[model samples]
Target chain A: MTFLRSALVPILAVVLAIASGAIIIELSGLNALEAYKALYDGALADRKGIGRTLEKATPLVMGGLAVAFAFKAGLFNIGGQGQLVIGALFAGAVGYGVTGLPWIIHMPLALFVGGIGGALWGMLAGVLKATRGAHEVITTIMLNFVALNITDWLTSKVWREPGIIVRTPAIESSAEIPRWSQLPTGFALAVAAAFACWYLLERTTFGFEIRSVGLNPEAARYAGISVSRIVILTMFISGMLAALGGAIETQGIVGRYEPGFNAGLGFNGITIALLARTHPLGVIPAALLIGAMEAGGSTMQFKADVDPEITEIIEALMLLFVATPILVRWVLRRRDTSEISVGAHWGDA
Target chain B: MNTLSRYRWWFVTAAFLVAFTLFTAEFQQAQTTAVLAATLRQSTPLVLGALCGILCERSGVINIGIEGQMLGSAFAGFVVASSTGDLLLGVTAGIACGMLMGAFLAFLSVSLRGDQIIAGTVLNIAAIGLTSFFFQTGRSLPSGKTSRIKLGPLADLPILGRVFFSNRPLTYLTLLLVPVIWYALFRTTWGLRTRAVGEHPSAAETVGISVVRVRYMNLILGGGIAGLGGAYLSLEAVGSFERMMTNGKGFVALAVMIFGRWNPIGAWGAALLFGYANAVQTQFQFRGWLADDPQFIGMMPFIVTIVVVAGFVGRARPPASIGQPYSRE
Candidate 1:
């Protein structure tokens, strides 16, 4: 009953977003029901659809965990895109540049390298914020552009295959993460990571310190917590999660790191984290739902003659509703008026 | 030394501009006016966006949704102009769309007391999605780009003429707005009240000023300014709409606002610096000076912004009550 009660708001938010999406479709002179039906069919009806949905959800799970972890440390890490790109590049570098290692050794090494690459990027923002009082929001955004320019340069100049396409050379066969009976191995890793995050946040002393800082940094500092250390560490871990998502995409799905192919996978993490109400374990269901919508978008466009961009609209609406539960409550006429825990205010440097 | 350090950014910018002009002259003789003109042209939307931030933040409302507001209005302007073949009408529709988004933001951030950043993120995501969903390719403007108007005798001036006197309607308006907004913010009675509310809403309330009303008004007005910037993109600059064409300008404008220390004139100055950097980059690309890698040059503005934000210049102080929700007892 408690679980159900806790779940009610997210469920309602999703419902409202979908309903509003339907209204938008209707207003656009398209059949809302048909579009939705087609979306459902494309995302979940067949084994192929389920495989695509799971494949899409894998990285989102890692991205969601990344953001949610940082929120616990009272940080908003918006540089997921940069971190992911860097991670993908690093993973690609290791996967292609390294010699003839065994499959088991090479794949793990690439993923680990990718995660560390992301961690370093994430830690850069944390260090700036801790030392110079730069806001993570601004620094992360700047880092994103820096990462993009640097990576684009690398891909086109140094790492480029001798071809017309602007992409890195493909990863070696040993580094490829195989899919078993249509279920990707990366998705399992993502699920295990979610559980690990849940355990760390729920039961560990380090997690307690992080959460304490998030709730009240002043109080945590007075209580002998190193606010700066926690901030840096949390960001490092967050970046690792996001970059791991990118690394996984390189290894499991894309086979090579292309500049435009992985766009928005990082930003979508924000939507997923908010939709899950910032719960570590709640990221899975949220990711799966969004992943399904994304995977089905093209099919909806094809079958219903409706724009696939509607999925993004619905996702945005869901974010708004989830972020402001007060609005949702007012709409639903609920008596309870508690707001969701927003970890940090923008005023925090 | 203190004064020199205080005016460090200014000195650096002036020196860089002079050096860049000389360098360009060395390569392409007599192209200084074109470069300066391009700088002003590129700074138009940036200045407008920064002014929008100034208006909203001065009134204690943190609006990170300037990009969304600009993009939405740009799309609206393009769609209306493309369909109706009326440029003025399209501009009106664009401003209206921006104001509508402003109202939505106000409703979420002010009335609902939600997180301002999240509210802004929603605006951005929704704008991108909605614009793309409705966008159709192959739409053309009825005429051409917004024509440049000559200011009589001023247009006959050597270098300054092309750089300032002769420009499109929106560009001129944007230049004019810098002084107008600076006066309105620092001189007028409304500005006083707005500042009072921004710094201390409770105190403003004690003095019989309605904080909520002031915030709502500023946000709406700011949204209109940003909307004008958006319309400038589609109607004046390109004469066609592209998905996410506002790109990262809105975010860059935030850096400009901070660089200017929240003053309209200062922000315009900062915007011009950014614009100059962009203009020089484009020229370099055209001339193939940095043909080996143009990416590093493109990264300069963003990198500089980070350094400035990290207090390489000086600490930028925001309004006291900025980003906080006010509640009346």
Candidate 2:
């Protein structure tokens, strides 16, 4: 019973908030039932819609992991956008530009290079935090803009793909990450990445060290762990994960590098990371859920004739509820596994 | 002793590197000077935004919502100035709007001790949505851009007049405000308190400092500065309200704060670095240097911003107690 209650907290919050929003549309003379039905159809009713949701969820999983990894070190890394930008730019560069390589070599090489680019960018912030005591959150955020500007410059100038639309040349057919026929490659990648993150976070010595430092750096230091190095490395890994997401986007969805299309994926990572309670394995479900909301948003907008702003409102309320889970816990008065153990390691770190 | 103390040498290095690159920029345009001036003027909003971040963080508040505050003020400033035709009046309205946002942030993050990041992001989302929905509110007629006023005879002058004072009075004011902000942040007794609170809020309270009060004051003040930046974007630089006039300058300003390493003078240097990038990019475009692929040139600033923040292998230093909400036990 307790486990059920705990597990239901996030689910209940989202369901109720969405219901309330749906009701508001109904009260505003829109057919709430039909609107939700359309949303359902748009998000999951069809194979293609499911594929779209998966495609969206791909980046969220990586972004969530990126943020979750940072959270384990008690660091806020808002630079996922910067990391993602570098990752995407470099990935596209490798994906489309590199030639004369075999299919296997080319595909993995592009993805690996993309992740490395993002990781390097992220590592810079980590090093700053580790050595110079810079706050990663703001530093990363700022770097995001710089990354954006630089990516814009590269795509428009050096990587321009012929006339009009200053994007890169499309990836070669040999380099293309093949889709599962009509199915999305994104979902498979996200699932694999989630397993990788789970193993790294839950079952590894490194994850243990990161969480230990996060909980109490002083104690972790006493235990002879290089706390600063861990902080830096965790953020690097986090960034690498996010970069993988961008690489996947390049390979799976958008085909070529285009500025503004992959917009908000990194920022949305923040939302996904927090929603997952910074849990490693939990990122998968959280990302899928958010992806569902995003995927269904247009349908809800079309059928209900409601503004898409409602989707944002729903997401916000969900965040509010999750962030302030005490309210839900107190109201429901139920015990569960998902209860966020706050005040556990506040000042110690 | 003065040799090590002379930090301007570092500044010189920074400026020289950027200048050398600009010179390397292919085929400088006739309007190169004008573009430089405009770019410097354009960076005013970002500088102001960075200053806001500096103040709030110095006083122990992580103000991620400067982006939202700036946008809110930009929208308000645009509507008011367009209708009123008085830049001063519109700017005042913009500041008030910014202050309101600051107050809310203080109440939530300071008094209520809410998570600063969450509070900020929530505000950002709300600001975007609210502004988008009420976008059509308060228009003189059914339509066109807003009215703008030139500063009159004071606008045309040589040297300091053209480069510094000529463009927009606000642009000049931004430069002047930097020193004042620096002195206030570093030298004054209040400045001491602000730093003390950020470094050790508990210790500050033990010394009879009201941490919450100082944070609240700085929060609102920072908002006002950010508001001024936003107003400059609309009422001065662009002279019209656009959906994303501030663009991601607020975010870039956050970087400048870090690149500057959380100090007033440092912020100025960082802003100049970013401003230099903007100037060079614009100049390159004007000279028809990258006319074939101008879109990529447009991305130079963002790229440079990230690279600069990444800062080789070195790290950036921030205030000791940034991003922590005060909760009295």
Candidate 3:
């Protein structure tokens, strides 16, 4: 009964969101059922559809893990976009700039560089918060703009391939993450990373320390945990995970460092993290659901003349409903028993 | 010495400006005037957005939804103005839309005691999605520009006139609003009660203040101001709405609020500084100094925000219970 009660809110929220979306569609003079049918068909019909969904889900899973990991440490790493950008930049640089290296050395080296870049970028905000009392939220948002302009400058000026196009050269063949006949290898890596995150958060002492700090920093400090160190380490790991996602996307799907190609993947991480209730393991399914919507968005747009941005609307609605689970409980007429305050550690922690 | 140390960044910025002007011959008298004028114009939305942040944060609400509110208002303003050909109607529509969003935020974060940041994030995503979706579906509207207001004698003043007198009505209103907001926040009895509620809600309640009511009012008012900022973007700045047209200005306004230490006048100053950076970047592009690659130049304001927020300027202290939801037991 407890489990059912806990699950009811999310389920009801999703249903309500879809119903609201249906209303909007109907009001727009479109047949809601036909539009939904097109959405489902595009998302699940063919092998290509499934592949695209997984392909999109791969980055989302990694990004979701990044956000969820930080949430466990009571940090909102809004710099996921910035971190991912730097990671992709370094990975792309390594992928195209380096030569004569075998695939075994090249691929991992590119990924490592990307991870390090992301980690370093993430550490900037962490270090600022730890030392200077600057808010991570503000710092991270600023970093996003900085990252965008930096990447744009680099691609358009420094790393340009002597062409008019504002993108880096295509990565070498050796640097690519080799895929199976149909499946992207990055998807498999994402699943492994998700499990690794789950294991790290659930089965490790470090994870315990992180959760302790998240639950109560004063207690964690009294318990002899170095709060600042943990915060920095957690942000570093979170950034590395997000960076790895961007690197994989560049190597697996995009093949180049193009501005705007990886746009919103980081922001979408917030949705994925919130929808997963900040659980590392739950991020996989949440990411997959969002990924499927994104994968099918174009198809839906083409088939039903519905805008692809409707997926974004649905995602946002889900976030709103999930964020305010009280509304769900009120609609369902359930007594309030959950004591977990999501923003308990918002500012001080 | 303390004042000098506190305002050291101001002096440094002044020195940098002088040196920049001396080095760049393109920054002639006419170019300087244009840049100054553009800076004031550009800062209008930022000032209004900062006011929104100030009002919300002062009342103990963390409104990261300023971006979303601005976007919603921009869309509302653009649609109404284009359809009705009445700028005032458009502006009102924008403010109403913003207030609606503010009310929703208040309902979720205040009354329901939901996670404020998550509520804000949800608001942003929903605003972007809804606006873009509607924009895609709706017919393209007229893109008539807002007529500028010119003061007779004030416009004749050399540099000050160009910077302050000649602008869209919204720009003037934004400037006028700073002192008004400052007075309301710092002078009035209502302001005192609001601060008391923000700092110590239980105590405020004991003193007969309605904490929820104060927060809701401030949030809605902030939303209206932010909506005006958004409306300024569509109706005055660009004459049309685009997807995500606020372009992180709302977030930057939060930084401005912090830089100003949650003071309206301080926020206006910070907004002007940021606006100057943007205007200078535009001027550099115009003069072919950046060779059309203004991307690096564009990063100035954000980088500067980080430096300022990292306590290089001065410490920014938010309200005591800024992000906390007050529940009267």
TM-score of each: 0.95, 0.83, 0.94
What is candidate 3's lDDT per residue for A129-152, written digit by digit as tens? 887877787888898889888888
Ranking by DockQ: 3, 1, 2
RMSD of 3: 2.4
- The per-model lDDT (C-alpha) reads 0.87, 0.75, 0.85
lDDT of 1 by residue, A42-107 (tens): 999998899899999998999999988998887888889999999989899889989799998999
- The DockQ score of candidate 3 comes to 0.60
Give stretches of model 2 more than 4 Å off.
A1-9, A12-37, A85-110, A127-135, A142-182, A255-259, A325-349, B1-4, B10-36, B80-89, B133-157, B172-176, B179-192, B259-266, B288-317
Query: Between prediction 2 and prediction 3, which has the larger lDDT?
Result: 3
* Residue-level lDDT tens digits of model 1 in B76-182: 99899888989889889989988888888888877877777788889888998999988989999987668899999999898788788999998988988999999
Q: Is candidate 1 or candidate 3 better by TM-score?
A: 1
Candidate 2 lDDT by residue in tens digits, B96-172: 88888888788877876666776677667556655664466335422323333345665455433455555556776
lDDT of 2 at B110: 83
Ranking by lDDT: 1, 3, 2
B-chain TM-score of model 3: 0.93
Instruction: Sort candidate 3 into its docking category.
Output: medium
